[model samples]
Target: MPPQRATLLQVAQRAGVSRSTASFVLTGRHKDMRISEDARQRVLRAAQELDYRPNLMARSLRTKVTKTVALVSDTIASEAYAGRVIQGSLAAAVAHGHLLFIGETEGDPVVEEKLISDFLDRQVDGFLYASMFTRNIRLPKLLHGQKVVLLNCLTRGAHPAVVPDELTAGLDAARTLLDAGHRAGIYLVGHTRDQVFASRERLAGIKEGLGDAGVRLAGTIDCNWWPDSAYDAVCRALDDGLTPQALICLNDRVALGAYQALREAGLRIPDDVSVISFDDSDLAAWLRPQLTSIALPHYELGWRAIETLLGQPGEPAVQRLPMPVRRRASIGRPPAE
Candidate 1:
């Protein structure tokens, strides 16, 4: 016959303590109940010997707090960047003694609502609406009365959010180019009205930096946030006889395409044209002339989102994690013609 499972009574008997004392120690309330240290240790040892595992459902039912937080994301596991966010968020949540429930919405609000409704039914402690990009999407109203945290998302009306400081990213990119001694024909590649909010901000910062140096916007082309678009943009610039000394791409994808365009046009990078971008994606390192880029703090954004939700609530805090420039081989002085 199988060995009989140990019960709380058996543990109390083994510890030679009152049932109430055993309960307090096992439930981690011994300090508040002023249970003796020796007695507490005995109870703990008894529990360990018994390999006692408390039923989480029973505990949560009694406490009325599940202690689980839901992280709702649009295509979370689909993107490389989203994976980093999840890692950071999970680490933070675990450190705070909270379990995380991950839900992927595939960019569908209806799906997100269903997941949130189910979470609410389960009495989840909080909600985190995470998006891959900083798009101004409306959150589910079912989140009312629940603590909501926005990660890599924009909350328009008095909602706390954590995002990359693209303004600094742009400035840093400009500073790199300026430091490289390339002033004439500085161009911004990729980015249009439909671009992500972070993209727009980075572009604005780049423009601001250039303006400070008395440099005018040379030209811009929509790269559709893709490598192909970037290549096309470079080709068009070449056809127009526009040889920019510096090309600031919107992100790694555009930078990759820009490199192709320049190579096809027989222009040596940094020697004939310098290239830089935002996001500092893995592709940046693989490029022939390693891409110089602004490294956005994606992981920190995830961690901060959880921290803000648990900490004391205050006026909607908008945190911009600083994005520093990652210098590499893609930038250099313009060739002396």
Candidate 2:
């Protein structure tokens, strides 16, 4: 048989004190209980000597706080690119003296409900409802009336959420091109369906930013937000005599496609045509000219969502974190007409 574990009774006996006195000392309630310093020292020494370990389950029975939180998401944990989000949440949870349990639902409602029920059964202190991409989400009914914070997503109205400032990033993209003397012949390369949150907000900001300069986009090259689609659309546009002075792609992938099309047409990046995009992914830097893009702040979003949920009490409101710009060599002065 394994060695017997030391208990509070054993510790009390070794410390030459009553069970209540040893309990008060171990729980740090000695001063409140008017426990003697000498007794406290003796109890601590006895606990050390016996290698006593408090049972967390037993302590939680008295405290009601299990000192743990759960992070439930739809495919965030599996995405290699989203690893930083989990890292950020883990760091914040640990700093607050709590353990973190992660679960991925893969957008399945039944699985999501089961996962959430399991967390609730364990009595996790709080919840982080996250999404891989920013959008409006329908929170599971099980989460109602519980402590929760939305990560990279939001609900219908006012709620606690941590999302990137995509609108401001769009505005900055416009300003970046305009500041480089791009007066006209600017084209936006991406699908601009208003049903999508990021697309609409980004387009609105881009319009507002360019309108402030009293300029407007020459046109939009409608295409799916991907490399091959972007490449085909841009190539066809160029073949049809579309001489765009600059292209503001929706994301880094679209930017890569635009780069390929521009190069194939013998139009050097930032020489004959300038370029800018968003997401600031690793692909942005690996490009030939290195695309100038706005960052998504993935890690910060995860960290701040946990903080909002577990930190000091605050009014429930949406928190839109800033998306900083990562300037590179993709943009420059407009070419001579």
Candidate 3:
């Protein structure tokens, strides 16, 4: 009961050209085939009028290239900030004339296996293995030797990767406060864990940057990376008469907690204690005095990974995109002591 789809023969008949000519024109081989420009245009126009579309399935069977890519992620689609990552991937895929299919595995190995198997069965041209956060990830064994690009994550193996330069961002964070005349009473407002890639790299950059200036963090508040944990820790620190001139939080969420704690203790931001943080999320700008923080290049990570995968052939390389500093009202000169 369904109507038949328009055929290439119909387009060729309408354009008054041979089927081979029509095929060449539609498949972007007109120049190689030495077809006339007029004939190519006529075939294109006829295809448009008749709604004739080449069957990708048949073409892929012949070419052995699907011209499609799959993006497999662990809970990446669930986060709001990471939407830009998907956007970047989609844009680059479209630019390369490839279709992008996305699948979320929710960090479940069984689900991940099934999702990847399904994509493989469908003969996807390539894969983008992405993570919601930047960290070390063991790529799926199934993905080995396949055309793949790692997004926002890295591995020991040499698979092309694109991640935010968190280390540089950390160095910038420290320098931001130092440039504002903060030499002492500077405390870190989040716990640093070696297992976490961002934590270790950012902390190392901060240390190196501060050390370069012949200074160091006065103390650490040691709190979880969440607002509530940071709130309690900062509140305790303040109650114990910890008078920090400036606080460098590990993330925007931690900075939010520090802000609440500072306000409750009759301390004004950048007036009594300047504050700076990382991860320039939506919450960063929404703060009372917009928080000065380093931005995570979520969109660029996705875009660059896809480009690395599908762009000019090259050796597998890890690409760490720069994380820009988003300056705002939160940073100021340390209060006159």
Candidate 4:
């Protein structure tokens, strides 16, 4: 047999006070209820002795607030690199004394609709819609008139969103190379055109940074975010005698391929050419000459998304988290002619 859990009535009986007095003290509304300090202390001491905990579900019924939120995502929960978003959201939710429910749609509208309907039935306080990547999204019609914060994504209409500062990331990558004295032979690897939001913003930032330093891009090879494509591109470029002083890869995967190609050409990292990239994935540090890169700031994006949904002040209408540089062994001053 199991022992019964202590209740407010037991606490009140132990403290020689009414149940209402015990409730007021436990809820931090003793002063409002005209509860005396000595009586409040007695109730608190009694609660401690009895190990009494308030029933949150009963409290929710009285307050009409569920104290829970739902995180609806299009693959954020599944992708390894983007999983930090959920970690951030969960931390923030727990800190604020709220519960979080995560649901993955995998781009399936029917699944998303079911999740939304179920969350609504459970009376969640708000919704957090997130994406695995940065892009413009169209929210479900059912989400209108509901409190929602978009994460790692934006929409055509005005709604709160938290995304990475890709522009700054790009600018920082270029500035790092330029500041290291690499000038004339800087090449942008992968992401040929601006089809993706990150690619476009990062490229723009790179251009802006290079233009400010009075240098032009030596060339661009569109590898489309594939390691094999990047390997082929780098090999072809080197084979054609196009040796860049530095390479700014689009992501760590591209940089990995670039590393292989450079090794095959007998070019040592930072000895013959410097390398910088973005999306500071785990592979960055794993490389022999660790790659210097910009982080995606996925955790911060998810954390801020919850804060925005909870009506925290000073949150921007469209928050852009900074993509800080993770410097490693792959970057150095350009080699001498």
Clashes of each: 0, 0, 0, 0
Q: Estimate each model's TM-score.
A: 0.93, 0.94, 0.97, 0.95
lDDT for each residue of candidate 1 in 171-250, tens digit (9 for 90 to 100): 88887887787778888888656356877788778878877888766788666779998898789878988878888888
Instruction: Rank by lDDT, highest first.
Output: 2, 3, 4, 1
| Candidate 3 lDDT, 1-337, residue by residue in tens | 8678899999999999999999989988999999988998999999999888789899999999999999999989878978989999999999999999999999999999999999999899899999997889999999998999999889999888888888898899989988999988889989899999899999999998899999999999999999999999999999998999999999999999999999999999888999989889999999989999999888888888888888997744888789899999988888884
TM-score of 2: 0.94
Q: Is candidate 1 or candidate 2 better by TM-score?
A: 2
Q: Over the stretch 1-337, how does candidate 2's per-residue lDDT look in tens digits?
A: 9888899999999999999999999988999999888999999999999999888998888898999999999999998767889998999998898899999999999999999999999999999999998899988889998999999998985568998999998999999998999989999999999888889989999999999999999999999999999999999999999999999999999999999999999999999999999988899999989999898888888888888888997745888889899999988888884
Candidate number with the higher lDDT (1 or 2): 2
lDDT of 3: 0.91
Q: Identify the candidate with maximal TM-score.
A: 3
Model 1 score (lDDT): 0.82
* Total residue pair clashes for candidate 1: 0
Best by lDDT: 2
Candidate 2: worst-modelled 10 consecutive residues by lDDT: 313-322
Question: Candidate 4 residues 1-337, lDDT tens each?
Answer: 8788899999999999999889889989998989998999999999999889889888888887989999999888989988888899999999888999999999999999999999998889999998887998999998999988888889988888899999999899889998799888999999756658999999999999999999889889768687888999999999999988999999999999999999999999988989998998998999989999899987888888888888556666898899999999998877884
Question: Measured by TM-score, how close is model 1 to the native structure?
Answer: 0.93
